[model samples]
Target chain A: MLRIEDLRVEIGGKAVLQNVNLHIPAGETHILFGPNGSGKTSLMLTIMGYSNYKVTRGRITFKGEDITYLPIHERARLGIGVSFQRPPTINGLSLRKMVEICSSDREANVDHLAEQVNLSSFLERDVNANLSGGEIKRSELLQLSAQQPDLVLLDEPESGVDLENIALLGESINALLNRGVKRSGSDVHKGMMQKRSKSALVITHTGHILDYITADRGQVLNNGVMQCSQNAREILKWIREYGYQECMTCTN
Target chain B: MYKLDSNGEVNPKDFSTEAESHDYIEDLAQIDGSDTAEFENVGVETDDSNRSATFILKDLSVVHCKSKQEGIEVLKITEAMDKYDWLKDYMWKDISPEKDIYTQQASESPGEGFFIRAEKGVVSKRPVQTCLHISKEGFAQNVHNIVIVEEGAELHVIAGCSTARHAERGLHIGVSEFYVKKGATLKYTMVHDWGEKIFVRPRTVTHVDEGGVYISNYISMKPVGSLQMNPITYLDGKDSIARFNSVLVAAGGTDMDTGSVVVLGAENARAEIISRAITTGGNIIARGSIIGNVPGVRGHLECKGLILNDGLLHAIPELEAHAPNVEMSHEAAVGKIDQREIEYLMARGLDEDEAISTIVRGFLNVDIEGLPPSLVRKLDRVIADTQDDMM
Candidate 1:
């Protein structure tokens, strides 16, 4: 559903992302692996179309449309959603109000999703403010759960939360996928909604996210450069046994 | 119309005399460093011969003083007179002795007068903001203001007054009169800040016609020795509404006596007054009174004070309802800043200054929605400057 080819970006007179290419086909989930200062967050921010990130040479296509120059809110309007690693604390704006503002379909079951992500109690609080780091993560997942987007971006969604909450995050993502299918109960048994695809590109520092959801593909990024793609499970096993340092010999 | 006589009081020049008026104009023209007038084309003149009111009456002796410690008494009177001259003709001629600056300042000459007149059905969207600064010591300022929002007209006025240095005695006597016509709306905001040794007495009154709305927001941030302000609005119109919201902060040897009185005289008239004061190093006495005279009139008064120092703060609220259908209520409180609230903000990584400024700004801020952009910008600056000293 989303494709990036040779994404070269410059920020503050420094190269943050250079010659990076990745593709997530329909119904596929991909994991982006990188260490600190490894351009992982930069790639996410670039994909989100934040200003000040100069895309010198790149082509980002989503749903067969070139959205490289699209504004952030416009891209969001076009069924693109993101969960920031460290979300901002919006003081006066309530969480429920922000969710309603960002979502397209008002008929979506918000209360059930809030209950599923453990954010039912924090529905009245200002967005992400006064919330514990773990609570903030769950709130992010809850907001994401309500958004039936064609493509989703998650940045370190499992960094600060507990294991159980992390599993809940996985379940919420699954629920989001199920909702995006738009199939009735009787038709679901017949796989009538199989034609619909839910795509996502997630960034993870640790392989713990692999424990929650099945990622179809994996790519390692270093200093704004991406290596060859491989199977997610094999890459997970490789990283677990050795580490990202194992790729030092293959610098090319 | 009543007139104040000169008995042991500094006398204003006989402006009723044409020769004296001519000479005064010539002197002001020379002092303003122009042959004619500075803002001659900006406003309307009383007559075709006289210039539009822009010249602020500033005395020569006070302006030439170089010493900073002469005390603010002299400069205060001069500054107040300057504003009075700018507003006089637009206001009424008769003022009570208690509201007269000539009686208060026997030695210093009074300031200018400000008068505003809006014809019927005039809707003014631009807010008028005036700033008065007392730079020298021994300053005495007497300013008089009169505003008339005619039928169906609207206006907003913002005033900021301050002294240059701390610990100087400045004297200020200001009188303001507002007349709101039927279906008109008027909003007024006044901020008072003066150096030490300053004594201020301000008297204000307003009369609302039928179907008129009046909103007054007063803030006292800096008061030197003693500051007394009495603001009143009389609602004589049916279906009229009046509200007074005041925020006062008295610190460091300051003494503030601020009060607001609202009287509902017509049927279905409504009035509300909210007064807040925060004292750190001095004493503050804030009082609010609401009187419902006609049947079916409604009024409420609320006064709150926060005492930061062991300094004394008293809040007295009173309500009077004569008619059976009228409703009146009053509430008053005296306390300190809530520590838990400050601690909560501090826990959010904001410094002490940031948290305090935020709290103060929020406390003083009201819904200024629908106000002009220019006025909002000026109010933001006023908040910033006042927050700087406390935080």
Candidate 2:
């Protein structure tokens, strides 16, 4: 239930996403594959409504509603949530308190969510203060579990994530998708549901996310222009063999 | 008292009257008291023209009162040659001692009169300290002092008043004035610790020149009836500054009405006034005002009071700014000391009284100034004693 057509973005006078077109349907988890500076992170940042990236021309429709210019908070309220690459350190504010504030249900059980993401130890700590990289990742997951947003955006979740909790991350994501039945009557069951999933645009530069999650469609974005949107396995194989130079030449 | 000649040599000032001046000299010579050398020109007489101009401070030890009076026992000292010249004319001939007229009950007779003045371009780095101690009952002490720091000069003075346990119905009224010249700086500290049944009224006026700076620090403890103090400051010259830092405590049926005012009349002038009070079994009212009229001038006033043990604290702060470019802000609040902090400290192993003492010390330490390290250590001991008493 997501659509992108002719997406063109300019950042710092440099085009990062050009003429990009892709579609993610209900119940599918898609993995994006590209080399460094392939505009994968830029796409995620733009989708999350970060102001640093400018959209020159594009249309992004989620559930038949255009949300290209929506503010970050509004998008969040509309069930679009993002786990930042680097969380900010906000002093005098507790992590558990923020999770409670962000939860869709005011009476959401905080201890249960904290246990799900292995963030029970940081309940009293200031938000992101003195948190290890892995701890911060789990804390973000805890928030994600609490919110249970309709569309979840994750950036470099594998980075700095300890091996002990990576499986927990995958399980938490799966549980988040399986929760809170919308009016659509379609619920995720953690199988080959990627084909009919509501949609997830997972951004990855090294294609490492493919090992943990499945993908239905893949796109190769070089510099600012999309070379092609092809099968996820095919793009992974091509990049593993001939490298991104092939994508650059294809864009030229 | 040492005397300074025209050539600036050490000598002795003659204190005897004109009729007794020769007899005093003869007695000194016959007694072989070499240390009591007299000077003929000492104790210079003041002219009537100069008598009405300078501020006059009567020495506390030189007065006699036959009966109890409601008004100040005015002591006129126009015949003293060692008197400071700037204070010769501004002396008030009469001052009221009525309950409303006096800020507090006057106590303890003073010993000898004293005078101090600063010439232009002179600076004194060390603070001149004086201690007034009253140990007798129904004793009235009156003191008037004048200070004039000429242009480009700097001076610091610290005065303290304390009394014995038996001191009762004591009255003290003192007035002090400062004349600050261009580019001059003056810092004064007044500390009061009086016994029960003591009344004190103190008024001070400070005038600052262009580019001048004036600072006053006041500390009060155990005022019997009431200790009323009003410090008025005027900053007329550009780039001038005036600051008042005070801490007042009124306990055991005492009432204190103390405040300060600063007027910034020129561009680039600055004024800051801060006062903290702790009231326990007493009444305290603190009010401060800062008026800034010129552009680019800055003024700030903050008054805070703590009420504990059935005491009352009232604070009012007013700030006026006429120039758009000027920064002026005033805030006042009266409340009890936070109980949460005390509980936290207690949870950390400190007893309740120890915790309270720590909080009071921190609150009173709003001005950890340039006091000597030794003096600071002594003050720490004093704080420890206070905490022990509270506990």
Candidate 3:
């Protein structure tokens, strides 16, 4: 559903991501494994068409349409949503109005989705103002749920979240991606996979999110370049044993 | 009207004697349709269902003034002064005529303003609507208003001051004094819309007794030539409270300097001042000050401004504590809209223009308590209608 080929990204005249090539087919969830400052979020922002993340070279295709130069709002209109790690606190813009903005025509989903994400009380609050770590995560999920996008980009979903909240967040993500209720499984049923084609690129540091949701593939990005891609669980086990430095030598 | 014992000859011409004066009208029904529309724009309507009392001042005359509610009293200040001998004590008692030239001019030749009072033990359900209107060119309209809320009473006053559309230039000087007795509550709101060449100066003072509450909200969004006002309040008795909220937007060629000061003189007294200003090629000076004179008092001052284009926006916030255990704090910011906030909204599916308008609207939407729904809706409409000018 989403493709980036030979992508070279720069920010403020300095190259941040070089020679990145990846693809997530329809109905698939890809796990992006990276250390700090490894340019994983840069790729996501580049695909989202942020003005500062200049894609100096390469093209991005979503749903077989070239969207390399779309504006942020246009990209959002074309069904791509992002959950920022540190969203800005917008004074006086309540979360309720934010949901209404995200859900253009389907405003009916605001209250129900807010209830599912456990942020109903927060709907009246100003956007992202003085929110705790877990509250920010749930607020983002609530907005994404209202958006109902075809593709989702989650940056470090479990970084600041506690253990129990991370599991609950994973369930929300799974429900968003159309994954089944069976947790700790890396396979989706054929009948279930054929029903929906919601794709996502989830970035994780510890792979603890693997316990609650299924990821079809995992790609290791080390220092501005892609290193390796393989079965999700096997790659996590290997990275846990050896470390990210070992993946720099893996050709597969 | 005051008779001059000095042969009716004035020297050192200020705004009062130098400017042209308009003829007085005996009845408001003789005015034209457009003049009535001008009155309605600033929250004065022909329909009295929404207001308990209505006072209309056209230039140097009180054309129409009456109170429909039995517990409330509304009349011209000059007539009310003669009706009740004690009313003279309330006028110019807290606000000195020697404070400024505007006060001097208003107190010396005081054209007719309103006198509104809430009787003791009465709770008014609807607000008293007052309109101060000038329909003649170069007219210097003087006004001195007195409002008294008796013990255990509640009152709300909504005053709209504006100039007639055809009247190009004018000057308005108003001196207002308010008294809130023990266990009383008063909510006063003023909305102003004027022509580009009008100069306005209003000096005001208020006093609150024990267990009393006072709230004042002022909104002026349209363009004016120049305006200056600084109203002060004194919380004298124990456990008294005061709050001031102002939303100001200055367009090109407009110069506005406005603020408020509150003094907490008794134990457990509290005060808060909040101001929001936006200038699009105009000059604005937003000021706030709080002084604590006793222990167990708290005060906060918030002044925030946004400069949309090439203009000036200055914020001055002052806090002083004279006793131990007095809590006072202030927060002030003056700059352009944060681009990060704009991008964050854009990421949520709003276009650039839409995102900017939303942020600007949010910035001006201060949480003011006790505003009637109609006035709230009118303020919302004004904010929305001026979106293009602010941009």
Best by TM-score: 3
Q: Is the docking of candidate 3 incorrect, acceptable, medium or high quality?
A: medium
**If the candidates were sorted by their lDDT against the true structure, best first, what order would they fall in?**
3, 1, 2
Candidate 2 vs candidate 3, TM-score winner? 3
lDDT per residue for candidate 2 within A1-252, as digits (tens), equals 667789988888778788887677766666666677778878877776666678889888777889788755556666666666666554334677667656645567888789778778888777677877777777876777676666767776777777777766766655666522222235344433443334566666667556666677777767766657778878888888888888878876
Candidate 1 - chain A - TM: 0.91
Candidate 3 residue-wise lDDT, B1-391, digit = tens: 2211253222213334333444444444555688777777777766777788889888886777878899899989999989999888888897888876667787777788899999998888788889998887777888889999999999999899999888777788889999999999999988898878788888889999999999999889888777788899999989999999999998888879899999999999999999999888888999999999999999999999999866899898999999999999999999988887887777778898888888887888787776666667777776676667765
DockQ-better candidate, 2 vs 3? 3
For all predicted structures, in order, the TM-scores are 0.50, 0.48, 0.92
**Relative to the unseen true structure, what is the C-alpha lDDT of residue B206 in candidate 3, on a scale of 0 to 100?**
93
lDDT of 1 by residue, A152-214 (tens): 888887888887677777766655655333344466634754546578888988878788777
lDDT string for model 1 (B267-372, tens) is: 9999888877777667888888888887899888877766654577888788877778888988877765554334323323234565455555555554433444
- Complex DockQ per candidate: 0.03, 0.01, 0.71
After superposition, the stretches of candidate 2 with alpha carbons farther than 4 Å from their true spots are: A1-252, B1-59, B62-113, B322-324, B346-349, B372-391
User: Over 4 Å off in model 3, which ranges?
Assistant: A180-195, A248-252, B1-32, B370-374, B377-381, B384-386
Compute the lDDT for candidate 3: 0.84
TM-score of chain A of each: 0.91, 0.85, 0.92
CAPRI-wise, candidate 2 is incorrect
After TM-score superposition, the amount by which residue A204's alpha carbon in candidate 1 deviates from its true location, in angstroms, is 31
